[model samples]
Structure formats: C-alpha cells, structure tokens
Target: MTPPPPPNLLHDAFSADFEHELRFTRSVLDSSNPLLEDLLGWDEQGPRPGLIAVVDSGLHDATPGLSKAIEARFADPALPELRETIIVPGGETAKNDSNVVESVLSAIDLNRIDRRSLVAVFGGGAVIDAVGFAASTAHRGVRLVRFASTVLAQLDAAIGVKNGINRFGKKNFVGCFDVPVAVICDEAMLETLSDRDWRSGYSEAVKIACLKDAPFFDLIEKNADRIRERDIDASRPVIHRCAELHLHHITRGGDPFERAEARPLDFGHWAAHRLESITDFETTHGEAVSIGIALDTMYSHLAGRIERSQADRVVEVLRRLGLPVHHSALHGEAILNGIEEFREHLGGRLTITLLDDIGRPVDAHEVDPEVIARAADLLA
Candidate 1:
C-alpha cells in the first residue's frame, strides 16, 4: 500500500473571549424612577443615542396611551431620544407571525438603528422574543432593553439571553443568543394582565423551585393562595428569587449557550414544548409546563427516582397555584413524539432532567414509554 502521502494539514484554533454585563432591575420605565437615566448614561462629550420602541399591541390597548408613556418617560436629556414607537402583535401570536419580526427589522433599518442605538421591547415573553430576535440580528446586534410586562417575562423568559421564533410547527426553531443590555421588570405593568395570564407566570417559578431550591418551593407553596388572588406583595418576592435563580444558572451553569448534552434547567420542557405543538398552541406555555411537570414528576416516581410523596407534593403545589396538572394532549402520540424531537434539539444524546427530590434534579438517558403512558393515565 502506498504510504499515505504526507498529509497536507492545517489546524487553526483560538478562543474568543466574551463578557457582557446585564442589568436586571425594577421600575425602569416609571416616570419617577431614575434607573432609566442611569441605564442610558448620558455623556456631554458624546452624541445622544437614538431609540426605537416596540410595544405589544395588547399592551398598547390595555394601557391606551402607552406610546405617549414611553415617549414621556425617555424625555430626559440623559436618555436616548425616542425615534419611533412601533406596535406589534402580542402573546404567542407575536412569535407565530414572521411579519411582526420583519416589521420591527424594517423599522430598525428605516430609522437607522445602529449598534449604539437601543431597541426597547415592551411586552410579554413572546413579543420580547420576536422583537429581540429582530434586534439581535439587525446590524449584527443592537443594544436591547427589555421592559418585562408580565409575570412570565419578569421571572423567566426575559431574564435569559436567547431569542427565537417558531417554525415548521416547532417552538423556537429559528433563533440567536444575545444578552440584553438590561431587563427592567416593571411590577406596575403586570397589573393589567388577566387572571389567567397572571397565574400562568407562576409555573416557571414552580419549575425552578422544584429543581434548585426546596425552600423556595416551600415559600411558593405558602403563598400559592395569595398569589392566586393576584396579591403582588406575595408574588413579588417569588418573581425576584426565581429570576435570580435563572440568572445564576445561566452565568454559573458553565454552558450559557447550551453547548452541553445535559440541560438541567430544561426540566419538564420536553413534554411542554411538544404539548404546545400537539395542541396547536391552544394551550399556553405556562399551562403546558405545569402539566408537563406533573407528568414528569409522576414518571420520576414510577421509575423509582423519586418518592410517590414527593411527586404528590409537586402535583399539589401545581394545583394550588391554579395551574393545570393534566391535559388531554398528554395522552396522545404526538406528545410522545416530543421526546425524540427534544433529543434531536439537544443533539447526540437523550438527556432529560427529572427530580429525585425537592431541589435536587437528576438526568436520565432513557424513559420507558409504558411508564410514561401509565403516568399520563394517572395524571388524566
């Protein structure tokens, strides 16, 4: 055999260092609050940065004069001049429409939004995701300031550095990861949410509490009734703690981009994502997550990873929080297809996060379909 000709080889490897500080605070858009000024950081020597605002259409309707509010709030000399206030569809519908994202991009280009300019997205999680995706891809990436207007956005979705839109009936199929300059959780904005939207936000808190903090779970359990009553005093601390936990996991979890096979933070998400698709998204994400958590908790018990009592407690908390623990879609084959889709999304291995106890999560490579069926039956 002819010796393999001297292998012409060229290898190049280098590390690109990345460091970005994200400000997470409250009351950023409040007229009396001074944090927006600090966030803008005016310098007399430099030109003022321009800003383009994107408000959720639903929010605009609820607040009536929302555009006026944004313009007035950013009127300070230290703050960026409001160039345009664009309204986009809200909720999951916002993400479902590509036109919404394109409209924002068109606005960005037409207004000459640059890297120095800021894209302030004011809406719920879905609107934030759609607008942020546009902002991240526009001019490579422009500074983004998120005004988290709902419980879900404040505590979970808007806290992370990922953005996407669904495609081919899959959740977040097209996306990029770009950290926002700041995420301002305005507690006042959440007041306008319907009762269902309000309760929908707590499922994420329950999810994190189950995986990372038993004490936090206990706190939520204690406050579930008051939270269901729409008591902000009881809900504020939960939102804050949950947001902190998510930030810690993103920064300290060592894989900010999900470059690893094991995704501990995605507990209960496999079924949740699939359920959303199977149901044609008739079920909201938070409600689906609550049901997914219930199913996974049951599976964990059946698989002998967690005690039946532990599973019961999880289901109880979800019920107390007014979250649904069972859905008709959970029993369908399309829902089971989510397991493989989730594995494909993660790539290489099938790693699923399941709880062995409160505040402690364990990863499993395989799940028995029979057991999953039984768990669904029990949930049903």
Candidate 2:
C-alpha cells in the first residue's frame, strides 16, 4: 500500500458581508419626494454611474405617463444618468418567457451597463425577478434598486435576495441570490393595483403571522375587511410587519440560503407552487398561497401536528380576507409532484414545515399522501 503520497491541498474559507435596505414612503415618483433621487444620487466629484430602468408592462398600462416620469426624474444632475427605460412583461408572464430576460439583457449590452452601474426595476414581483436576474448576471452582479409596484411586491416578494425566472415547469428553477441595494415600498405604486391584485398581497402577511407572530395574526384578523377593501391606512402596519418578519428571518433565521433541512418560511409553499403550475399560473400566487396555507393547516391537524381549532382559525382568516381556501386540482394526485420537485430543489431528503399551533412551526421529514387526501377532502 503506497502510503498516499503527500496529500496536496490548501483550504480556503471566507465570509461575504451583505446589507439589506428597505424603505417605505408615499408618492415616490413625485420630484419633491426625493426618494428616488436619494437612492441613485451621485456626488459631483466621483465618476458617475449609469442607470437603466425596467418597468412592468402591466404596471405601465395601469399608470399612464410612468415611463415619462421615470426618464424625467433620473435626468436630474445629482442622480445616475438614465441610459434607458425598458418595459418587460409583468406578473407570471415575466418569469415564464425567456424572451423577457433576453430583452433586458439586450438593453444592458446595448447601453453598456456595467458592474458600477445600477439597475432600477419598477414593477410587480415577477417583473422585478426577471429583470433582477438579468442585472445580477450581467458582469457578475450590478447594484439593483427595486421600486415595488404592488402590494405583494412591497410586503413580501421584493424583500428578499432571490432573483429568478421559471423553467422546466418548475417555479424559480433558474435564479440567483443577490442582496438588493434597496427595496422601496411606495404607497402610490400600490394604489395603481386592481382590487384582486391588492388583496393578493395579504396572504403573505397571513403566512408570516402564522409562523412567527400570533399577535400579528390578530391584527390581520381585525383588519381583514379594511385590507380587502383597499384601505392603505388599515393595511400599512400589516404590510410593514410582514416585510420586517421576512427580513428578520432572512438575516437571523440561521438558514438564509436554505442549506438546512428546516425551512420555516416555506410553510405552505409546496402545494402553492404545484397549484400555480397546474393552473398555468391563472390561480395567482396569492390565491394559491391562501389555499396552500389552509391545506397545510388541515394536513397538520390530520397528522396530529396541530389541533383542529388552530387550523380552523387559519382558514377562517384567509376567507375573511376574501382569499380562496380551496381549488379542485389540489383534490387530485397531480399535486404530489410538488413534493418531489421541492425535495430536488432543496437538494436533499424531503423536509416540509407544518404548524403545531399558531406562531409555532415544526418540520416533517416524511409526508403522508393519505393524510393529504383526507385534508383535501376536508377542504372541499
């Protein structure tokens, strides 16, 4: 046995520091607001960095003169030079199309966007994700500033380090993690959202409240009507709290990149992702999440992880908020594919989060299809 000749190896280890900034304000596009200006300000003495703006096509349609406003604002002397203003497909369409990513990349190449430059994305979550993916990969990551244009974007979707486009019939199959320079939640942009779009965001609030803060759940329960009615005053605190909770978990949850077997943030996501794929994304992420939450809660009860009363409270709150708690597809076996995809996505043995009680989450390594069938029936 030739004593394994002198092992040649050198170990390397280093930590990369990151900072996440989230700001909340109203009327962000107005010149007097100074929010956008502050975000992209360039000192007179330093080499000016360029900026390219990407707006969601859906949001552009809703807000007339939005492109003009963005161009006019970034034209200021103190802000980064506005190189181009591009509009991409919005909602899930942004993620579904490879052309959308290519479009943004073309603009980046044509305009010479660089590492020192910035990409300002003004849109809903899907558009943001698609554009963010483009910017992050361009020259190995560019600074990104997000102008969250929907309730869902402001409170949950845009408040993370993920930028992705879906492929191979899986949600976010292709993506990258780049901490954003800033995530701005402007009240004016959300006001442009339709009623259905508005209510879609609160389901995320319900999700965070269920796994982290029971008191927050009470607040949402109390304001479900006002939120559903599109009253920003009643919905503001819930949105902020949800955003903060998500940020907190990302920074302090010990598994920011999900390298562990426990994923508390994805409590109801397994079914939600499946529902979206089956429905061809017509179900809407928020509606699917509402149903997913209720389904998981029902499953938790059936599996003896949570009491019936707790599960009922979870479903009732979603209903009061005017969100769906059931869909016919979930009643079939096709949904089981989500579990396998989820396991593959996480790159290990299956791990799913289930509720033991409000504000308390437990991880289950093995899921019972029988219990899922029973839960689907109960939901029906």
Candidate 3:
C-alpha cells in the first residue's frame, strides 16, 4: 500500500562535457616544439607530473633512433618526469594478447601513474588502443598523450575518443570510450613505414571519403599513385583531410560514444571486422577494410542504392591504392555472422551504413546473405 501510494519513481538525467584535441606537426620531441610541453603544462597535480612512456616494439625496431628520441624527449626538465620507457608488442599482437594489457597496467601501478600523471604512448593503432585502455583503467583514469606513429593511427585510430583491445577472437570486443589529453601526429614518422604499411592506411582515407565527401574521394582517386609510391607530399593532404572529417563526424555527428543505433562512420566495417577475424588477422585491418568497402559498395549497387559505375569506382580506387578488393573468406558463412555480431555490439537493431551515392550514406536496418554473396561474386 505504501509502494502503491508512492507515485512511481523519480527520473532524472545529466550530461558531462569533454574536450578533444588533435595536432599535426613534425618532430614534436624536438626541443623547439612547445606543443607537447604546453599540453602538459603545470596543473594542480604538480609542476612536473610523472610520465610513463609505452612505445610500440615494432616501431622501436623499425625506427633506429626512436628509443633514443623518446629518452631524450622525456628527460627534459620542463616536461613531465620520465618514469620509464616500456616497449610493448605492436600491430594486432598488442590488442590480442591479455599480457600486453597487464604489462602496461603493471607498469602504471609500479610507476604510480595517477590520474594527474601522464602516459605518453607511441605506436600504431593497435598499440595505442591497448595502451590507452590500460592507462584509462589505471586509478580510474590517467592523462594520456598519444604519439600516433602510423598512417592509420594518424588518420583515424589515434584521434578517436574510443580505445580498446580485442577479446574472445573479436576485434575491439573489450574497450571503452575515453578522450586523451592530446593526439599528436608527426608526419615524419610515416617515412619509417614499409611499403605495405604505407599502402594500408589509404583504405581508411578511401572509406571516409566515400561516406561524407565526394571531392575528397575524387582527390584520393586522383592521387592514388603518389600515395602508393609513399610520396608524403601527395599523401599528407589525404591523411589530414581524413582526420578532420573523422573528427567532425565524431563531434558534430552527435554520437561520439555511440550510445545510439546507427554508426555512419563504420561504412564497411561489419564485413571488414569479420574478415579480419576469419582470416585470423592474416588479412590486415586496412586490407580487410578495403575488401569490405568493395563488398558493401557492390551490395549498394545490387540494392539500387547506388549506380554500378559508382560501385566500380570504389573498387577501382581501393585497387589503385594497392589494397585488397576481395578475400576468399567472404564466401563463407562466418562472414555472414558479422551482421548479428555488429548489431549486438551496437546494442540495438542492426544499422549498417550504405551509400546512396558518394558523400551520401544511409543506414541499413539489415543485410541479406544472398545479396552479400552476390557482392562477393562481383568482387571476384
């Protein structure tokens, strides 16, 4: 009777604000650059907060002087005190192994990386994702400064507010959304990438262009050769514009944390993620994404959402950039599971982004396996 007398329950809502910052420069570790120092300026925490450096092992191996650079940069009296420089596995290994996360957390605990202190992470997308996860979870959270060293990291992964590691054989299955203190993209780092890694990053550029900007797509299409050849002059614009477009979508698109159903930025990610898992990561994310874009573009054509010529153009661009357009795994039933898995990830009805035309993306409620088979056939 007392419960009945009570008028149901009280309901309320609250909101919080966050700031996301990104910078593009060369030699941020150089003594002349004030960007890193300014970002890490004195706060109530301390005049010189502790900083733990977690670097990608692959990057450390690839770039001969990189370890020396990190040591030199953090040794400066003006910046945060260098706690220790820890080298973790790079690429998918960083995200796949639980030990990577533990090692980072262990380092944080050992070094006492508090919320006010900093975890300056240097690596590609995977290492950043994993290290960021460890940093965010330690003592609730810690200030993180990302040195995005790879093309993919600079253009897409590092700038995002989300971070995570793979789990249960799923890509990014374990992760959280947390903004970093700063995301610094040093273009000089791209010069260290191999031919394959260099080519891998452009697929993301192609992906963003297809979803939101026709002119950007055209620009990428036009400069495919120079980009493939590792011409920084030709590639920098694509990387910058892609980063800007992604940042805009995350902020202005009104769903930075993906609390809703639709995920427009994931234009072809369903198939892409599936392909990566199915291939046991033999197919790189960028290459898998290239294949995903091709598969979905053709599906759009079959669904009458876009013209055949437009779909062909998407495939053509991916190929010109030296990315894969198809994988044998797409024909398997495992690939079909991504639709439901994706829906679960989003926590609602299926919402896949398909293109009505370049620069015009529409959410698809569901995908047909037969139609997907047809798309795969076309790619073949």
Highest lDDT against the true fold, candidate = 3
lDDT for each residue of candidate 3 in 73-183, tens digit (9 for 90 to 100): 778777788889999998999999999999989999999888878999999999999999998888889889999999999999998999999989889999999999999
TM-score: the better of candidates 1 and 3 = 3
Worst 10 residues of 3 by lDDT: 39-48
Off by over 4 Å in 2: 1-6
Model 3, position 149, has a per-residue lDDT of 92
Per-candidate Cα lDDT values, in order, are 0.89, 0.89, 0.90
Tell me the tens digit of each residue's lDDT in model 1 across 167-224.
9899998999888888888887887898888999899999999999999999999999
lDDT of 1: 0.89
- lDDT string for model 2 (313-362, tens) is 89999998999999999878899999998899888889998999989988
Candidates' TM-scores? 0.95, 0.97, 0.96
Q: Listing every candidate in turn, what is its Cα RMSD in Å to the true structure after a full C-alpha superposition?
A: 2.9, 2.1, 2.0
Local error of candidate 3 at residue 85 (angstroms): 0.5
Better of 1 and 2 by TM-score: 2
Where does candidate 2 have its weakest 10-residue lDDT segment? 35-44
How many clashes would you count in candidate 3? 0
